[model samples]
Target: MTRRPTQLLLATLVLTVTVGGCSNQNHTEAPPPSGSPPAPPTTQGQFTLPPVSPITPTSANAAPTGIPPAVAPPQVDAAPFNDPLRVTTAWMRQFCQTDFMEPINENLSRAATYATPAATAADITRGDTTQSYQQMQQQKLATRCDQVEASINPEAPATPSMVYVQVSAARTQLADGRPFQRLPLASTRRVVRGGDGRWLVDSAVDAG
Candidate 1:
């Protein structure tokens, strides 16, 4: 009888040990397989960095990193222009200027801001057909300048609201990093004080 009771107790203890080992095995965590990529970080809010290379602005897209900021053009609407000649002269400087040797679409677009709405459309049309200021090769122009002398003509007196100015710009172009010369341009430009109380170039007939 004693042997029988001892055998029963030993069997019960072995069964309990086996069940406990299985329970522990089920609760333990397992690590991921080797060579697999780590899981992405989990965060409450999302964020991303700019894609490499594209955010860096090129010479053709942005102003030259070395040059100073350009001086603001004269205010065209600060009451009636006291000296129309002086005003138009300043306008020419801004209108005929380009920064970083940007091509016509990039550089001259600023001047178009001073153009009348109709004139702006006409300029785009002309640029597409008759004249092209874009360089054949992409390069920063050393400088582009126009020395303009303008005067309001008194001979054509048909329309009082309209004013005619004879503009002569003696230019030196360093186009596409090539040797260049002084090219003179003459134009009979029609300027009008638009309804916005600003002077705008309405029409221009170039005498090249």
Candidate 2:
């Protein structure tokens, strides 16, 4: 009977031990497989944590290694007209005088020749009168420049240098067979660098 009771107690203890071992086995879990990515740990009521990123540095502004800032050139003012080409208002004022008229008319003739054929023809037809266009030019100048006054525009642009001359004169007329007093005349002339780069009278016109 003592042997039987001791054997029973041993058997009971062994059964209990076996049951406890099985319970612990069911509760434990195996680690993820090698080469498999690991799952994130869970927080309260959540399955996984959000992803985290690695930090990178940034600069406000960056310039290239060898570049430099741009700078502008300085500007200078131009020189006086009379000082450049030795031209004065008096010189240009004589374009209409008889002795000076031919050279100026020659320039005009050249200008007209280069014009359209119709214009050149018209100039020829009108040039036939006794008061030839050249003579008329002289007469008109005598009448207008009888009382000549000149004003100098000191500053003008020229590559080899030039001068601008202006003349204000008067026009006279006869009314009722009596000569009338003079009326104000206005004209402008440009002295420019010609083909030779010498300052020469290039153009003249009635400013008004």
RMSD of 2: 35.5
TM-score versus the correct structure, for each prediction: 0.50, 0.30
List residue ranges in candidate 1 displaced over 4 A: 1-84, 98-103, 128-134, 139-143, 158-160, 176-179
Q: Which candidate is the best by TM-score?
A: 1
Residue 70 alpha-carbon offset, candidate 2, angstroms = 64
Determine which window of 10 residues in candidate 2 has minimal summed lDDT: 66-75
- Whole-model Cα lDDT of every candidate shown, in order: 0.53, 0.40
Candidate 2: residue pairs that collide? 81-154
Error of 1 at 15 (Å): 99
Query: By TM-score, how accurate is candidate 1?
Result: 0.50
Candidate 1's residue-wise lDDT over 1-208, tens digit each? 3568889999999999999999998886678889979999863224222122332443223323232224354454554243445545655555544544445544335555555677656655654221334332233343344456888877855254568777665444444333233444566667777555566666776632
